[model samples]
Target chain A: MSYLELSNVKKSFGTTIAVDDFNLSIAQGEFVSFLGPSGCGKTTTLRMVAGFELPTSGQISLQDKNLTYLPPNKRNVGMVFQSYALFPNMTVADNIGYGLKVTGKPKKETNARIKEMLGLIHMEEQHNKFPSQLSGGQQQRVALARALAIRPQVLLLDEPLSALDAKIRLELRLEIRRIQQQLGITTIYVTHDQEEALSLSDRIVVMSKGKMEQVGTPAQIYTSPETEFVANFVGQINLLPVKVVSPTQGKVKVGEQILQAGKFGHLNGNPIRLAVRPEELNHGFIEGANNLSGKVEAISYLGSIVRIRLDVEGNPISMDVFNERKLTIPSVGDDYQVTFPVEACWII
Target chain B: MKTKRINFWAFFWVVLAFLYFFLPMYGTLDFSLRMKKGVLSLLAYQKVLADPQFLASFRYSAIMGVITVIFSILLFVPTVYWIHLKMRQLRPLVEIITILPFIIPVIVYVFGLIRTFSGPPFQLTLTPFKTDILMVAGYIVLAMPYMFRAIDVGMQTIDVRTLTEAAQSLGANWAQILFNVIFPNLRTAILSGALISFALVIGELILGDFLARPALGPYMVEVGRDMAYQPAALAIMSYALTWICLGLITLFSRSNNNQRQILGR
Candidate 1:
């Protein structure tokens, strides 16, 4: 059974619709991520679930209780903001114990919880320090501790790691995941970073322009993107136009090449976007592989992966080939041949 | 060559400004000290400090300053917060209203206040307490610009909406959000605003003069006509009081030092 559900949720500000007809059901203790670019409705959906934004028309329920128009105070939801909204006036301990104190928790319980949270975040020595005295990552951890002190039913994190340095962001991301897993709390993380979403989420909801484009597991989202937008937004993808020549045998025509591809299961004899990842294509053809020949236009050496942009009959195709000890790097303006299996081509 | 020219200009202004501000103060101190014709004496300071009128007027203005500060806080803090959090479209209108005191001259505004409340159905000036209330209202209007700007800037520095939401989500009601969360965070801002209002109310001459109130401003002017050294003494005392206010603000901000402090090292 779903622990939290948003049904037909819609939010509009003046004439601008921020979230339109959003529908989803999250199981208990599930780690779900709303992944989208700026101006998408992912943050809005998270805000709605947290009772920060009242949906124009929808039903949001936790278990059996309806929380459609509940104010944030009665929602029992905890949130960590991007700016780490820790109370500057309070010390780290006071900030973490704030929720407990306000909710009339006993002093002994609040003190014990604050101690536990400090130990969890590994900042016990810095309990008396102010937020301005700590680093940005430390401040955000205190913010998370404060949110979790209330023992909320749902945890909402809105781009919580976006404000940190790259190294600290990675470390804190792992820490947050560890904490969430240990607590077994239902969490909704919102971010535009695809790698962050893909690595951290049990299920990912890709959104665009106030609408959900696709919702699936990370592996499914990466390998079998249902729409063109999800395929492009999630990772680097090469989209080439192709025409279905035979519907029965899953045959497609790609620029003077007849390739046996996956079944479209839809319309035939119409041009569609054929999606393929850069790493899917190799530098040489093995047995029973479809091949493409092109002139390399640009070469970017990215330490582990050598990205070569190839111009194949006026269409640019980006291919990432791993750099092994024995393999020679490709140069620009060189004619190269790369191939992928027929099943790797995804028609969207 | 460019460095020399910039240094010359900067040095010129520093010296020019020093003379412009320091000369009159130096002259006043010299005249006030020469009470025994040739020798420097503390007779003027002694006379001013012992006078009954000085003590009454000073105490009255001090009380008036406190009243104005309270009135401004009660009036502007919620108004500014409401306009910021919910009534966002009214922000521009509210800003213009806050700056209205700065746009209209103080003497002109006092005249309007007198004309509006002097006669007819509401003759506030006839009763002493009513006229004192009117004086407090005038002081609030004059202090609106500084107080509102201070508070609005404070709200902007922190994410007011996000903080409010965070507090509300933590089971805090509106009163808790205001008192426990926002009011504590806005201590420096409130202190700064209160100090500025206090300074303005105690030093103001036009309102007290026109309203026929025995505040410090008119008492100073009244003393200037009969006494020479005593007026200079009062000037020095007022200058010291302003410094004391500035000193308090610096002390408070240093304690609340998330931002860089400006005074009282």
Candidate 2:
């Protein structure tokens, strides 16, 4: 049995469904992220798991125990809010010790746990200071420590790093993942930033408009998205509208170029979209399985990589190539031929 | 050039407003501080401070101020929180009701209170406890507009729903969430509203006089009618009391503003 299981979970607010038929089985010690844009129900799913929100119709079980009717306080779940939600009046130590104090633990044990929690977040020196005295990053750390202080069975983080600056957000994301792994706690992180989800989650659950779009390892979700939304949302992809000429051998015609996408089970002489990642397209003409001649409409140099926008067969396509010392970069208005591996393109 | 002209006119109007507002206060202070012969003397202050009636009124007013603050907090803070949390849909209606007391003239309410509680069916005016209860009811109504707005502003500063959920997830019950999480977060708002309510209770005149209670307002009216110099002294004392309350509010709000800046909100 999975450690934490959500079966057909659905949530609705009046006429609007916030989460619909969401199902996932999270294994023990697995760090999973619900990744999507705003209004995608990622936060709602996290809240349902944390018992802050009740599922409209479905079952949520932790270790084979049904927990649908239980209130949040009895759920033994911890959550870090997007706003940090640190108790403003309490000192760091008091905030960390809050859970222990609430559960009627002994004073000595609560004190020891608080000290240990402060050390865990590297905020020991800030124990005496109020949350309002801490910086944004420090406040977030304190919020994390406070949530984890009680050793909850499940840790739910609702975009905890979204409030910080870019540099601080990156630093804290790694720190949070490290802490979750160190404790081997089952964690559910919710975020809209694709890079953060990719780098941090063991698996990513991409959601859209109150429905689960796809669930897979970060690599799988990025490389082979099942839906057009996922492919477009997970990363920048050049979606070329195509008409399938043949079904069995996987042949499609885009503008003037006839392309073979290997054997795709779904496309059968119907108009479908093919998604190609920018990194998969090459800059120069090479005799390959899949090749297209196009004009370089625009070229942007972004320090480490050069982004080239091409007008291929009257359709716009983008390609990202590494900035190397020996290679000649493509200039705008230059006619160039680009080639990519057949397996890299997927029909959606 | 147009912008500069607009700015100049704005500054001119602001100065005019300041003079219009403060000139009466300046006249009142000058009149209260001067002696009967028109020379500035401490005599009015000394006479006001020494009178037994004036001392009783001050003491009663101070007690009522503290009582009103405690009562207003007890009644309004949780009501506002509940409205924000569960009855969010009813917010506009509740807000209208809270401010209704302020809109209705105090004289009308005072008359209603006296008639409703005087004898026969209610008979509340015959007993001191009943009369005190009536006074508290009046004070609550009088203070609701300011108190509700203060608490509402506080609620708007933070995501109360998210904070409550966070607290709940951490094993805190409703009581813990209210006293520890929600109330502490609302400290600045509560203090500000409490200060305003205290000042209002100390300075209020209509309800207490109509109810025939020994509250500060009636006591002040009695002294003002009988003693001329003592009333001026009492006015000065009241001004000092109001200044102190307002000063404390300013100090608290400044610190709260600093904290908001630190949070970068």
Q: Name the lDDT value of residue B235 in candidate 2.
A: 69
* Model 1 C-alpha lDDT per residue in residues A1-348, reported as the tens digit of each score: 999999999999999999998999999999999999999988889998888889999899999799988999999999998888777778899989988888899999999999999998999999998888888889889989999989999999999999888999999999999999999999999999999999999999999999999999999999999888999999999987777777777777778866666536664547865778999988886666778888999988899988989997777999997877887877888998889887887677
Task: Tell me the tens digit of each residue's lDDT in model 2 across A87-166.
Answer: 77678898899999989999999999998998889887889987777889998898899999989999999888887899
Q: How well is candidate 1 docked (DockQ)?
A: 0.42
* TM-score between candidate 2 chain A and the true chain A: 0.97
Q: Candidate 2 residues B121-204, lDDT tens each?
A: 888788888887778878888899999999999998877887788789889999999998888778888998998888889889
- Residue A260, candidate 2: how far off, in angstroms? 1.9
What share of the reference contacts is kept in model 2?
Answer: 0.53
Candidate 1 deviates by what RMSD? 2.9
iRMSD in angstroms, per model = 6.3, 2.6
